[model samples]
Target chain A: MSTGLIFAGTGAILFAMGVAGVMLLAHLLRRILAFNLMGSGAFLILIGLAQRAGLVDPVPQAMVLTGIVVSVAATALALALTRRLHKLTGAYTLPATRDD
Target chain B: MTEFFDPLAWLILLPLFWASGAFLLGPTRGARLAIVGVAAQLWLAIDLAVKVGDGGTAIRHAVGGWGAPLGIDLIADGLAAAMLLLTHMVALPLLLYARGYFAADASVARYFWPLSGFLLAGLNALFLAADLFNLYVTLEIVGLAAVGLVAAGGNATQIAAGLRYLFATLIGSGMYLLGVALIYGAYGTVSIATLTPLINASAASAVWIAAALMLLGLMLKTALFPFHYWLPPAHGGAPAPVSALLSALVVKASFYLILRLWLGPFAPLTGTIAWLPALLGSAAILWGSWQAIRAVRLKMLVAYSTIAQLGYLFLIFPLLGPDGLALQAGGMQVVAHGLAKAAMFAAAGAMIHVTGRDAVADVAGVASRMPVSLFAFALAGVTLMGLPPSGGFLAKWLLIDAALTQGQWWLVAVIIAGGLLAAIYVFRVLRQAFLVPAQGERRHLSHRAPPLLEWTAFTLAAASVLLGLRGVDLLRLLAVGSGP
Candidate 1:
């Protein structure tokens, strides 16, 4: 029970940190890392949830695996877009305003 | 053989299949495949609507022949069918317009076919999704396709916009996945129908947290109020048909998820955070419309107008408290706004094609140069402004009727005020179009858009108007299923 509590708590904290990072950070790379952090946090929570069930639940495990794959794809695409933006604009951060 | 005939699987699968083909085969052959695939999708959607409307029962297909709960299930009732009708109807014309708009040598053309097809499949899957986790997967598909389409412009600003959009959507979906995990951990199942009875008042905190997380995610994707910062830049920067799709369908996908959750698995928590959506929605309407009125770019104005239009959808949450009528009113509003917005974007795109400018003032002489495109824009504006003989008018009437019956006079005021605001932004362009510049030389300099492009936009605009008089069919279709 304590193990379950620790893992779930840690997962929630990591997820919250990701959300904050994405919201507060301006740099594009930091935001991408934050997104990945959030995904990992969510996956940790999924794992912790299965642990709490007291038996290894295959369903949440399957879901976590699928989630990892999706996370990879999203991160890859985001990085590609970021690269394109940096190449075109010579900046790794989004402009503070929409005006060009 | 029986499984092969299922439209639900085909609806979600065929476009994905064709998208792969479009990519592997290159654009020349790929564009043709997309045209054929979208046409087939339209046919399939119409067939499903006709069959389901007549049968008065939803059609369900379990993938891999697995039943609900054990494996993924796709269900399409009246709501799903109507949205499908909206999506495919808008897509068909946009496809035709795109055929003319893009030069053969443009690199973006190659990507458009595959990305659009992928987006379509994802949307259909989202509408049909009965499983929460499945909805997440489809959401990712739709989100990625949308970001890809936005980046098709391949410029600095457009890429920045796409990157920002990707971040916003990913965070939203990530929160949603966390919520799904919580719900599954608590309920032991991820299917909405299965969890409907399982989720009760006993676990109100868990349900509340989960619902809040999911709703937050969806609202972010849908660009409600402050979250709408990512929307205009992304939508405005995309090429025209892509803009129409993103504005018309992609945003609606997330909103549809919100509706599904509210009415389905999260039904137990109906009273939880209900008023918040409506409050935020009211703010979105006023702020968005005001911004639209002040916007200089034509596409930006239209994008802001979307934010305003989305506000009315949230009004249902508050009004649904007293009367079930508000739910239908909201659905009707969805159909109305979706059609009108798509038409508006398409016509604006055609105008930009001729004038080679995206600013409302810069395109002043386009009115005379391309009367059909301008007329299409004007007709679509009627619907956006909620004028008579337009579907927007009918939708607002329903919503007002519901609010009045419930003694929600404040909502009535908000509705009217929103309409007036919509009229202001819409007419801001029409007023520009009406300006007769002394120099007629500019008209000669502008290129002529093909009739196909003008007529495609016109048909969508005309349909939104016609939908006003003939909304009974759609309303009847919406009435299916034991609903809120």
Candidate 2:
């Protein structure tokens, strides 16, 4: 396979896995990690797309830089919220069946 | 030529600038600054709307004097302007209502002002951005700020709900960013204006995949049916004004983004899956209203009604052909729902404040106790139920006409059923307030809402009705920059 194709394919597979994990797992921490995995997979696709020529595409690089900052902020916020949730409920996984 | 510098950018920047100042000055002073800032932003919004509506041209601005493909740009078309006007109009009253609603809670009020401004900035930025990546960034800001606002309620329920909202929105943004990456890889640009023609020429697979990915992400953010589980709790748990803003403004911003993208770059490719969102929307209407009918809490009922109202906007997606008339129909639906829902939430907040509980049964006899607030609720309900002489009626009329012209009888049935369901839930609230208590069982709350709070909600409800009375001008304004 071409290098770009292989890399893009890997990103796609990782994204699918991350999505499945986020949806299936009830653990909040695991869900956060799955989000990170999703972000990393997306980052990989951006990097792979940028490698189309000898020189990387600067636009996607710029976007990836911004994306990294956003992802970091999101992870931090998710962590903060998770901690708060744990403190409030005394456990991480949502209480059995009471959404309200 | 003035080199194309547009003041439309200030509609976003002023709120952001003031938001920064508000954050620095603290919440009380920040709230005062927000008042001045939102007022200035409203002035700017109206000025831009008048000019754009009159000139019949979009106002485009390139930040830092850099053009597209290399630097970001902002465009204020008729649709974005309509949303801007709606935000400013609704925000000002909500801000005023909040000033009184949280008058005693100094702690929550402190961060509330800045977060609200930041959310408004994020919204205006989302509507005005001309690029996909920029839209993603603004969406992130909107999501984070909304979570912060929802969390501002500070209870365990609110915080947990906010966290769930944050998770859902973050995933949505991640998926949206992936689509942006794919589009850039295929077309070498992320600018919406640039991608319009290129998207039409690109291979069908790449285009369809990107469109599907992006629309999926936006739908999650929009809380369309299956993904709508996070919205009610988050919205219901937030303080009244925050609930109003979240339901009225934030969710609509994401929907507007979907409208902008589909009508702009993906317009040529929308013929394939037009029925999908319509089907989902039909389901959301049926399901959301059914849930609203059974909702025990007042805020949860309003939140579920928001889900149902949002479905109306999506139903016309399949009907939006080259005529672009259905777009105006959708736009009108947005304005109708935004105003009515804001008034409903604000009034509900006032009632729940005095009652000291959110359960529908808890609000019995509050109708005569808080006549102004109950009147506001009933008036907003009139608009929400698509009754005549209200914006909801005009919007529904236009929507039904569109569906009729397109011969979508199933959607027509959904539209009618949606109105009936809305009527049931709305009167459910009113019934609790007005009908539950028998004669001589009348009562009054020891803690009555200030007249300012009552008037604010009434004004918004009145505006929704008055908007219908002048539907021509609003439709004309929406059509200005929406060229075929």
- Give residue B382's error in model 1 in angstroms: 0.7
Clashes of each: 0, 0
**lDDT, model 1, position B449:** 88
lDDT of 2 by residue, A8-95 (tens): 8899888888888777788989988998899888888877865776567777888889999988988898888788878888778655
Instruction: Estimate, for each residue in B373-437, the C-alpha lDDT of model 2 and write its tens digit.
Output: 99989989999899999999999998888999989999989999999999999989888778887
Runs in model 1 lying further than 4 Å from the true structure: B321-323, B438-443, B482-484
In lDDT terms, how accurate is model 1?
Answer: 0.86
State interface RMSD in Å for all models: 1.6, 1.7
Instruction: Return the top candidate by DockQ.
Output: 1
Off by over 4 Å in 2: A96-100, B1-6, B201-204, B438-444
Q: What is the C-alpha lDDT of each candidate?
A: 0.86, 0.86
User: Which tens-of-lDDT digit does each residue in B255-351 have in candidate 1?
Assistant: 9889888887777777766778888989999999999999989999999999999998998886774345777787778888888888889999888
DockQ per model, Cα:
0.72, 0.61
Candidate 1 TM-score versus the reference: 0.97
